[model samples]
Target: METANRIVLPAMDMNVSEGGEIEQTEIDHYVARAKGGAGLIITGACAIAFPYGAASMKEPGLSDDKYIPGLKALADAIHAVGSKLCIQSTHHGKVARIDTANDRPVLAPNPQDYSYSMKAMADCTPEELAKMGAATAGKQTTFKTMSKEDIDWLVETWADAAERVAKSGADAIEIHVAHGYILGVFLNQRDNQRTDEYGGSLENRARLACEVISAVKARVGDSLAVIVRVSGEEYGQEGALSLAESTEASQLFEKAGADAIHVTGWGRNPFDNFTDGPLPNKVGAYVESAGHIKKHVSVPVIAVGRMLPDVAEKAIKDGKTDFAAMGRQLLADPELPNKLAAGKPETVRPCINCYLCVGESFFDDTPFCAVNPSLGNEKVLPLRPTSASKHVVVIGAGPAGLESARVLTERGHRVTVVDKADRLGGTMWFSTMTTPDNERLLRWFKQEIKRLRISVKLGTRATGALMRELKADHVIVATGAVRPKPDFPGGDLPNVQTGDTLRAMMLGTATAQEAGFVLSTLGKTGRLSGLTKSPEFVRQFTKYWLPMGKDVVVIGGSLVGLELAEFLVERGRRVTLLHEKQQLGLPLAMPRRWTAVKDSEAHGVKIHRNVKVDRITEKTVEWTEGGESFSAPASMVVYADGTTSAAPFAAELEAAGIAHDVVGDAGAVNYIHGAIHSSFKVASEL
Candidate 1:
């Protein structure tokens, strides 16, 4: 492939096959990227062998010649738009579970005896370990490992696959040697422990990978370019190769005749370098890893870590790396390169890094970008605008409203956005104030709205009179919902307040000193003391108010409650979370929720499940835990019980016979995705 100032759309699992045949959905998905003007389109991981190589049952396969025709069609569609295509060949190692029903034994570099019972590496028997080692050396499975005799066989398999891919008309081939898969295991010391020629040292460990590249190169010659994807850092263990070690491996691969190196970092550890951090971490963070390897090799290096165009441009301009390979960014906006080239970068949708794409791959077999609704729906939804022009009125400036407005405007509609608040963002304004990390999201929203040029009227409520005057052809009521506060005993007292009220006060909207004696009751000391303090303290106080004082008790230990308690305890405030439920953050995913719980526990936050708050008196809260009555003194009572719509305009909209839609907290309390999705749907319909 010619080295241009363009980005390569890297392969991501887009589950678009049934019975190993390319579905039309897959074709449309790749074609969209090609049409969007991507220089190269890398198809998602395709299995080299059937049940053994497949990561999931739904993943597409190129295990047999029969799969070639379907792949040919995908290549044709992409090529029609003048963009080159590459197909990634992959084999899952121990990550593949050996099902007795399938009658295939899972293969790994070394034996792994740890299953459901084993916690660490010590749980394995010597015999089982030996069997595993033997199996890796070409034993039971139909797809045998490369012995000296089997070396030709393995080479032939790759050569034949490459030839078939060439016949299918792809421009390049990428060897999947990352994410702890088959080839990756052979490279990492944690997995490959063989004392043999193909294991002990870094050179030995890299032998299998080099052999695969050599085989593929010899078979295809210089007719196609070969790219190797490598994990720059393996998360947990010290035995794993670092950037310097991986650079040596890259040198070996380059000498073995690879065209380009695509660098990535992975493993189970969340905080590992290049794996975890903020949005900036996602952009250009892995370029240094690529640079380290690039210095040792002659081939071009591709940098990938949630790259946006500006970031990717900087990397290329600064000579950090040769080309930028994008996965999530392309998923978010397939036409990103084209848009950037056309000087219309604002039209691109940014990836929010919500992990919804990763979550979908486990179940649906294909990744779905949250911000880009067209993802996974490529077969059904047209990427280009099809709707006829119409005047669409989107009420509210929340995420949903903004998304709806953006989509509608893009679909050749005249969009007018109105919000009761004096600004674009609704609850997000206050919600985002809680954390500095989340401020980027708000900035993204602001940037997108300004770029779209959608006319927005701030502090303007949608009414029947306004609707009639504007003569909107369609009305999208994304006014949003409110946080519900049911009547509780003593709730109407001056000291009692809802979550929104506290948030608003702490956010500097409502003066804490002016909110009557309630502020004084919370141990404010004086009027100005609580109201006019540092912005950081206000943020901390608003989000997790309990930690502002010496001792605090939090009611309703849901996601917000638990996070608040955790934050408070971390800030040196003693916290006791009282929840009526059996578990905390029940609505959240098990992995994230459990991780939060464990971290919170580690931070010394006391958790009391199956507990109910009876009432709150000025300085104390009464509650029952495990059916026993308990009382705790409070410096301040913080409500993290979630929010309900506090906007009074909804009833007025209904009373005035105005057509409007309520979304987010107004329709019901939900997460960021809910708000964005709801708004998109409403806007699309309008």
Candidate 2:
């Protein structure tokens, strides 16, 4: 039952299983991670009572022998790659949508009023809601409070599931007692309210979980390691489990035959506080709690929640936690452990904390990584080796162009990257100012460009004549999108600025004519000592010395506008955000979108939806909502809209009889996800 290393790939629901059986898609997904050098791999939530108390039909099942063959295939595949496999067993409890679909009441320890703010859902489109509703077959959830007989049935079912795991040849079984599952409900004071033996005190509340754990351990009898997952702390709710309670629960479970404690956290309310726990946005999210639990337990403690390699290495080195579970990071690049072992951390792709992957899981769909196009379709999307080497010219230095160059070079092609901008990471570099997680990705691309030693010609725009002169066998156009000026009145005013102009100003490349008085000051002062080149320096430098006035108005409330509004509000500006559409943050994933809308509102960003801009003056912005006109005082007007996909060189290349492929925003504007995925697809083929 021993693993080769301390890195653990925690369970992340692929939602690709079929009727409680593990499909090859799910098997290949885990196999990829094992091949990438992870020491331990945990399967996504497997139903102990398949299709009965299950959340989704797509989750793997261990309730019957029919599922054993699929499980065995997965175990054998992972073991052959020198990695240990652990199966996470659980009954989804009140969150089990399958029961509701079948008209059976979802089981719970107690029935109480449960509600959360729907404000976050205000930005979700109808299509997204429909997909999410399809998980439960459009049925409303109903609850059934568990009785003593039900408890006995659950305990027996858990032990039976453990037997199935042992027969499947897995090294471990993780008992689920966290994230508001059946056992977690019995452990948390907020969910369990029974006046009987299973509730009323800490020991009573922990009794059901301990009974399940002990039953599973006894059933498996040292044949499999028993890992217990618990929420070290519950957030955004009163009476939630605290560190003290969870530490004590860990000790109690240890006494109840648990082999290890895996510490995770829950936000309680998904719509309002998801980023605070579960899959947190913060780095090293649950390390402290896991450390505290480790102090009181003899078994190894596993910490999960945004455990980046550096953070995990430091935490383990300092004796904070015995293992680090990297979930989304592994999805971004399964070979992270292998790269680290090879002492090439810079070569590992980073998860940008975009929430795109988890957002798909909310709809009971397969999650895909933005950086890794081969996430779910591992076998199908492998990088193919080219038959012969050829010179390839990639036009642009952004994420798309850089990625295209990197992959082309790897496939035995000589590549030269040409960009009009002086540096790499086109708009993505500018994006780091508002989204810091993007910085890691930009840095990764930079490192790759340098490590591969691809010839880069910056500040040099590609032309038809230039392409012919370079004599490249092929060309990839990733020049990005074009941000046009607004057509509305006052859009041409001196104070009004588009995303491109603003980026130029921040980069110290904008002329005095392009930048108004307030921003022109930045170009002069920020360019000194190479300060403006660094996004971090510019982020902090602008906080105190930003030239903009207090009151600002931003036109458009899509991804860029929403994030910009939030950023401005953080910098102490009163921002008025206007959108002509009903839903804000259109292309952003639902979870991140919900959090961004909540955060923008929380930061006092005045949001006006379904509005048409009438005009903009130097001192104010006028807009009409319904039949009424509204005005907001604005000293600075930012037109964060009118961006469209454009590749002006495509026609010229076509006429010259040059073979070219258009990718990224230049082909279609889907932002970073589109840029990376499109680049990978195009480059892999060439």
Candidate 3:
């Protein structure tokens, strides 16, 4: 509770809790951050009540005294490490999935639309569905609109939760009224159509928030700091809480006993709120929202959403708000505060805005980072020095190989990473041409390799002879995948290339597709890339500046194809993508799939699915859709279909009788998350 810095580690659901008790994994996670020097650490939101009000059983609970001991242990762990701990309490209303509590009713101000959680509750017994709170899936199940008695019970629940939080040794209590949860549901005029005292005008609509605050304050008094999270502007729903209404709500909250106002944005769909517990929209995406609320409130304000250290520090220095809350950034690196204090931001692995953490946490309580695989396993998996260190040779420079090398070195092994390219990132580097945010990941990995003093041999394609010459104890074959040679008539024409080949040529790195066996020439590779002045690389890629003509035909409709189409369109090229599948993005999550299709369409790329390529000439491509055949003018044809293992490379290692294991694309090709996770598992074992 005492003063430190203004940095706040806001509550993020760390899907590790089980049966309403915090798991040891979750305890270890918070303790790791507390040791890393966060000023304040807020536990993931705990349920104020059971079954009906709780979001997920995997999330910790404060609904009863039985949960106190686990909360106490979590608090003591952080307190002993010199960090203040806060517990967030919530009632999820209709959003409650009730995965474990099939007997609890789904309550809301009014009947709401369907959600993933409600659908899951449908499989409950018919007897259970008849309960006041039970839900049945595959059919329309409306909410049990809260009665005045229900509202009073919720108020008492908050006060009880706050008392329990204080007894558990938490320094502060934050009421969850943001992100379309139960409390937020009551605040939204659109959701609450009640003619009762709790609904109607702005002040009337906010009566529940003020009442909850007053009740909580009356119970905890001055023993705990009270904070309320609110949506400054609910953009997602019609006639939801607006900035002006929420601004007035903030004043009323302070008057009712809130010590701080936490501002967040809302989307039309409560499940997918903008920029919080979601992929960050942009740097300081919610700063303006916080600033607006801050002007109207006397209490301290916390601004969140993809805030970098420099940006957070500046906000404090400029007095835009009192505290900066970082969720995903801290999840990426728990030592973020220490890194900033030590002025070593480059060493910090940045979040790539991938919604894996969010998607995982919501669907299953197993949130993990895309760039940092060590997350979510802080208690079990480790990088402790091996009892007997082995000399390790890694045969790729992509994410998988890089991760293997990093962990191998941490295990006190002498590590050597060899790649055929002059860069550290394998295909991930080529991906940065469209997604520049991930470019920093390459830097972080390069920095770690340098810090650990691992040997990196770029432009050195590992061969059996090379492995034998190294006399290594162990070899990790992450040689990665290669583009398939899909045969089409006249495909051998000069303008035809795979997505990888085109990307490499454009980035000033001549691909093996073009340069052939010479890619094996071992050249001095640096961590930094300077394409504009590298004479050798520039000369090799000179003819590739305009490799494709204006009109292009992409031969696949996979994720790779969609991305390639976007990149091509950004460079003023007209693209037509042909795929055998009915959908453009096959086997991707809805968020990722929708984004790919949206960006592709926004770029005006023509897409024809269920099409079979008939033939390709130097200047045109003939393809069939349904039962119809058509020919289109195309000056270039690019392969975006798929890839197969770099099989020969692994076979060479096997033939030499060497002790090597293949990870990632060399064994399996599942793109980024799969490749990184596979490498982490293999490297940890090594």
Candidate 4:
């Protein structure tokens, strides 16, 4: 194994295996990780038994000895690249949706109501519940409660599966004892309530987990390493195990024969666990939990929580943990370890933690990385460079343009990036400044550009003449988009500002102070501290400009409008958002969009949907709402309708006969994901 503070790609639901057999494509996925310099990989959760233990139908299994060959093939592929492979064995107790179990009732430590409280295990007849309980005891589900004889059989069944895995030539085995699954329910006080020896006190509650570890170790012995995965904390629940309790549980498992501990955390919301907190950004956020256990146990501690190399290195340097276990980061770039080891960490694709990968898992059981298009398809797509040489010019320095330049340069292309703006990151420079979390995107752009050694020229607008002057073999246009302000009566009136112009003024790139103040007063009474920090704009408003302080109305309900309203509201402005659509920020995704709407409403931002603004006036806006003509008083009005491609140089490129591609909002007004994906795709062609 490679001896470095590198990462171990943790098990995730890839949904590639079928009926305990490894698919060739799945084999390729693991092989690519090995080739990418992953020192170790833990395969997705593999069921040890049918129905009860299976987390999903697409998951692999080791219940039958027939799966040995497929397991062997998977192991051999990783071994070929000098990497170790492990299988994660899991049993989804109550959390296993009954729908995924072929209509069979899910097994849990105890019968409880689901979150919605609409479903309960008690809803089923006593006889039916007993049948499931008996099945867990290894008997046919024809009886109530498991007989003593049945319980003995199920334990042996677990041992039998472990023995089979040992003979399958796997390097290690991880017990999935977290995430509200079977073992998790037993360990969590909120779930388990058995009066018997299997529940109650901490030690009693840990009985099931300890038993599984002992059984697996007894069957496999020192031949294969045994790891226990546990959640550090259960969020959104009361009386759940805290970090201390989780540490205690980890220690118990270590003493029960587990060779390692993989620490994770459970959250009510998906984003909470992956990106919402400092834990996700802090390398080895779980290290403290592991450190607590490490202090009491001899077993190795594995830390996982969206770990980056810098954080990983710091954790190791501080002796906080033994290994860095990364899941999403690996999905973004499996070669993370190699990149770090070579001191080329900037090349690692950053995981934005948008949860697109998690969304894919729910849709198809096959997880896909938003940033790394080759993730799930790595088995079929060649990830290595096809050619070593090409001359390329990337137009536009937006996320798409920079991403294209980065990828092309990595493929051994000579790349020159040009943009008309005075800096890289077309609209992103403004977008990032909108949210604290988004600032990382801007950091990523600058870091990647410097790492790739691609030539960059700011303030150099791309033209057909420019491409020809550079003798570019390939050109990529990522000029992005411009704010679209459709014709409205008095559209050209003073103080009628577009979102882009306001952004420019906020960033101090333009001297539109009067327009900025007018827009600011439209949203807030007078407080604009949260919207921007342009001292000059603030001073101009406090001095020469008149603060409308008048009731203001805004047109459009897109993201820009919502944010602008928020800015205005924070500044003590009375703001009302008017749109023709029924919903605001229609392009936003669910849950997040829902949350944004709630936040907007919390700020007292009025929404007049199914309305149209027909004219702008010095002190009022004329509009029709719900089929009635009306006018709303306004000191200033800002339009955040949408955007359109702004590639004035496209004609120049056509005239110069230069081959090029338009991407990002410049090609089609969209979000950042589209822009980066488009850039990467086009860059790959180059």
Best by TM-score: 2
lDDT, each prediction: 0.68, 0.91, 0.76, 0.69
Candidate order by decreasing lDDT:
2, 3, 4, 1
C-alpha root-mean-square deviation, each candidate: 6.7, 1.2, 5.4, 7.5
lDDT of 3 at 487: 83
What is the per-residue lDDT of model 4 for residues 89-160, given as tens digits with 9 covering 90 to 100? 876665453223345556666566335321223123354445444323422222123334534555677677
Q: Per-residue error at 447 for model 2, in Å?
A: 1.1
**Candidate 4 ranges beyond 4 A from true positions:** 1-6, 98-101, 117-154, 269-284, 379-391, 435-438, 472-474, 486-498, 511-641, 644-648, 655-657
lDDT, candidate 4, at 662: 82
Clashes of 4: 12
Task: Name the runs in model 3 displaced over 4 angstroms.
Answer: 99-105, 113-140, 270-278, 380-382, 488-490, 507-529, 532-547, 582-589, 630-632
Q: For residues 247-345, write the lDDT of model 1, one tens digit per residue.
A: 889989989989999887764332222233112234566777877777788888888777767878887888778888877778877888888889977
- Clash number by candidate, in order: 17, 0, 7, 12
- The sequence of per-residue lDDT tens digits that candidate 2 reaches over residues 1-686 is 68888999998999989899899999999999999999999999999999888989999988899999999999999999999999999999998988988889999998857677777777889998888888888988888989889999999999999999999999999998988788888888888889999998899999999999999988999999999999999999898999999999999999999999999999988888888878898899999999999999999999999999999999999999999999999999999999999999999999999999989888988998888889999985567888998899999988889889989988889999999876788999899999999989999998988888999998798998788889989999999999977888888887788899998888778877778755766775676557777889888977887788899999999999999999999999999999998899979888788889989999999999999999988789999999899999988888988889999898888998999999999999999999988998899888
Residue 637 lDDT, candidate 3, scale 0-100: 82
C-alpha lDDT (0 to 100) for residue 99 of candidate 1:
23
lDDT of 1: 0.68
Give the lDDT of residue 211 in candidate 3.
Answer: 96
